[model samples]
Target: MGSVELPGPPRAARPPRPARAPRPRRTIRRRALPYLLIAPTVLALAAVLGYPLVDLVVLSFQDMTRRELFSGATPPWAGLAHYRSILSDGFFWTVVGRTALFTVACVAATMVLSLLVALLMRRVSPWVRTVMTGVLVAVWAMPVMVAASIFRWLSDADYGVVNWLLGLLPGLDFSKHNWFENPWQGFAVITGVVVWGAVPFAALTLQAALSQVPAELEEAALVDGARPGQLFRHVTWPVIKPSAVLVTSLCAIWDFGVFNQIWLMRGGQPEKDYYLLGVYSFIESFAVNRYSAGAAIAVLTVLMLLGGAVVYVRQLVHLGAAE
Candidate 1:
């Protein structure tokens, strides 16, 4: 009887709304599409840069030579022999010393030249500044080899234009000076060439940074009876400090890997006097065809660069913290 009460409209069990399948999860690759566009460039870098560097690291532990340049033939295992030789050899030490000296001289010269140029550019009329900028760009645009060749021709002891110019000076050494005869001479030549090539970029960078410095701040300092030296030391120098650091780090890095200058000029001659770390490794690899030794030297060079980068990064961190 109760059932017959006929579920007068058995409360319609509401059909559950069709449960929508959870939206398909977005894939990480889809999210990364923007960055994936850079894959071609990264792949190219992997081919030209990444593979060679990896090969170098692997080859260091193996006794690879010109005979096995690209062949799959296995190289003999010479665990650390090349590395030990590199570390103990007096020649490598000499290269290290020369490399340090070259970096210091070139960096210092480049900084000084760049800072002076920046100051001069700031003081000059806009047109003159523009002209100087054009000239610097021109010099920087010239290929290193072309510049080196020109300098080489001009560096010839007898017919060298530099020697001739020195003769015109009131007090100077006009005698035949072989630019590549010794380490210091070789370094000086390299330093000069590097500075000439590098100063423009530094100058431009500093000039741009200087332009951003508040003129009112400088004027305020001047009004406070600040001498030019004091103004520079207190106001200009602090404002430009970051730019200076950047320039120094960049020049240091550039000079560290400087191969063409040393290769064209010194070729690691005179008991490996002028041999820099970059040139030394290059000669080890290509010139002498000692892949293992070259790889070891290459590893050392990379370590040096990485060490320098670490120090530079630490400096940047400190600079940032200071700010």
Candidate 2:
């Protein structure tokens, strides 16, 4: 019985464990990879933007004028005098208000229109979708200058296509209408141009985001008697929210600093009424030769933008947590 107990079933062999890299080395590699990947971008941006920013800040502290600029003479330090002047100027506050309102209007219009277009693209047939995508891509590829030029021509004071089209309607006479005569009307036209150019990018991005929404979830919601709004609110919105946030912030920043559209529309000399932060800075620097003041304005503008970005990011964090 003792001898019979010696020949039991053979035990299964275990595979040998592979040797692991050291934990410190692996941890360091993992930690450094992201920074390494982003190093080139950081270098490129610093090379391009870093020097100019430093110079701007230095210039803001100096009483730089055209005389000193052309003569290559170092301007005397003016301390915070320029900033004090800008802060005290009522016109500066007005421009800030105008810029903010303009940005809000343009961003709102662009997002609404873009969302509608994205939804339209999603619901259409394949062929129609293809054609729509093609059109959007073409639009997105158009340069800002070209788009602004086209819009300017369309809303020209005389012999404009917009006026012609409006004239075609009975009891409406838009012929020879001067869109820029009224600041409100001019701003409306500029907002249209901005929205037109911004919509394609936003719509395309949203369309892509919409594709990530699970068809199964949407179907289940529909099956449960969810209304279209309810379905979108409960299912689609959560998926597209991040993309929407990105587009919105970018649009806000871009619109807030809009210069070329207004400048080009006004033939490189935007009137006081049409002056945004960008134009105001440029005019103060180049037009009025108040370089120090202009630099101060520019710095203030950047601070405002950064503040807004911080607020927006905080809001997004809170929203994400609440969801």
Candidate 3:
């Protein structure tokens, strides 16, 4: 019975289960994918902008003379000598004053004209708006060099339409008169060109901001015995204030460093009387071949603009917080 029972039960063997292959380890490329995607842009910026800035800083610290440049000799370290010379010069202070005055005038004029245009845009008929927009776009599309050249030709001492028109005035004798002979007049001309060139952009920005304002608010103000000026002051201004400030800051920055317009109009004429920071920088670098000095002027100009930008950004932050 025991032998029969042992034969009746036979053991069955089970096959072994297959092992799964280990998951592929995350490669270094997988971790750095985002940065890798932006690598080309970052490299291009570094090559174009970053390298030039570094070179400028280095050049500013060295006395890079024309001879050294030609001879391919290493420039000697000036060690802030250029900055000291720039600071000690009385003429530099005068140039700084002129630059400040020019910047202020141009920015003020641009803001005023642009604001007026923007205000007008809101009330104009559709056809008028189309025409106005076309004009603005055309003006904005005009090249800076082209605009400057046109202004130059128009204000020419001889064969200028502007001088011709002025000569028609009975008491005024501007016929073939050198408008650029007087420094103040030259500055005025340059300011006019800058303001004209800037208005289109400023107006467009402001109109866009104005469009965001609720129509009901304006109507409500008008219904409540508010005059046009009062409606703008109470209802419109509060909303557009940030945009206005931003435009002002941008205009100030652009006007402060304006070179082509001033240079093309009057290249540091009348004993450099109308020399702005931009003009001075160009004169020092190319005209006089004082590369380090020019670089110093450029650095200072950047600092000034940075200060303005900081103030503007702070004001915007405050406005946002208040809201």
Candidate 4:
């Protein structure tokens, strides 16, 4: 009772543990780490690419001729004159249409073939998958110029392996057939080269994405009697869709700017029919000596590419955030 009486005095409430100070420094560091990591890349890209882009845009607004270039005279500004001329020209529109069509053909073919190859990789034995992966890596590692050269040889009119093989088909002869004589057939060969180079990367990417699909989900769907197409649409496609969209966007950008295959195939002198935006720009600049016009075309090409670039960046950000 005495001890209880001594405890009767209300003990001062223990001071609330001082609220922990917010570690502003650590919080800042954590927030800043990502930007810091990417800074070098941003700086390097700026150093490498910034000046050219700025110069291109400036040049697009000027009237620069080869005469001025050779004489080392300052180019005169032309405001939107070059853009007006290009936008008004029917031939420019034709080239734009052709470029669009070519890009679609190449991208569509590449996505289909790559998806098939990726699915095949999933179905094969581990050794087969390994072999396929090695082949894809080898193909991906091969330089674009070298691949273009090989395709040139393979499609050579006189001694092409392709022509020889096609000649073997009964009631058909492709021997000494000029693939580039018809623009349609020529573009088909070009599409083949584009798809060949593109498929390996896309297939590899899709294969990696496919690996992340939940097996349990697929099995459950199968057990529920889902058809193959239904299974893919419901279970497999969702997992791979992001990768596919990214790949398709990239393919669109690349194929939209295709130049090397057409140029090399046509022996560095692509015809008017073969003029994608890049080829058109080159022809306008060097071939026709319209520097300002070329720059304008380049600007337009960049604008067209922006849509795909935007899609790619958004998908990449989504992927990063999801992880």
What do the candidate models score in CA lDDT, each in turn? Answer: 0.83, 0.92, 0.87, 0.93
TM-score of each candidate structure, all chains considered together = 0.82, 0.88, 0.83, 0.90
lDDT of 3 at 253: 81
Worst 10 residues of 2 by lDDT: 1-10
Model 4, 43-154: lDDT tens digits are 9999999999999999999999877898999899899999999999999999999999999999999999999999999999999999999999999988878888888898
Considering only N, C-alpha and C atoms within 3 Å, which residue pairs clash in candidate 2?
Answer: none
lDDT of 1 by residue, 1-323 (tens): 35454446558687888988775567666878878898899989989999888978989999986566578788889998889988999888878877887888888999998999999999999999999999999998999888877777787887999888888888888779776666566667777888889999999999998897889989999999999999999888888888789778878998888888766654334245666787778777777788688789879889988887887898889878987
Q: Give the lDDT of residue 222 in candidate 1.
A: 90
The residue-by-residue lDDT of candidate 2 on 142-203, one tens digit each, is 88789889988999878799999999999999988999989999999999888988999999
Model 3's TM-score against the true structure: 0.83
- In model 2, the Cα lDDT at residue 118 comes to 97
What is the number of backbone collisions in each predicted candidate, taken in the order shown?
0, 0, 0, 0
Which parts of model 3 have CA positions greater than 4 angstroms off? Answer: 1-43, 267-271, 315-323
lDDT score for residue 322 of model 3: 78
- Candidate 1 positional error at 203, Å: 0.5
Off by over 4 Å in 1: 1-44, 70-72, 169-175, 266-271, 314-323
What TM-score does candidate 4 get on C-alpha atoms? Answer: 0.90
Candidate 2 segments exceeding 4 Å error: 1-22, 311-323
Q: Please, what are the lDDT tens digits per residue for candidate 3 over residues 1-323?
A: 35454455666777788898675566655878889899999999998988787788788889999989899999999988988999999999998888899999999999999999998998899899889988999999998888888898889988888999988989989877887788888888888899889999999999999998999999998889899889989999989988899889888888988888877776434257768898888889998899888998888887888888898888779868977
Per lDDT, the best of the predicted structures is 4
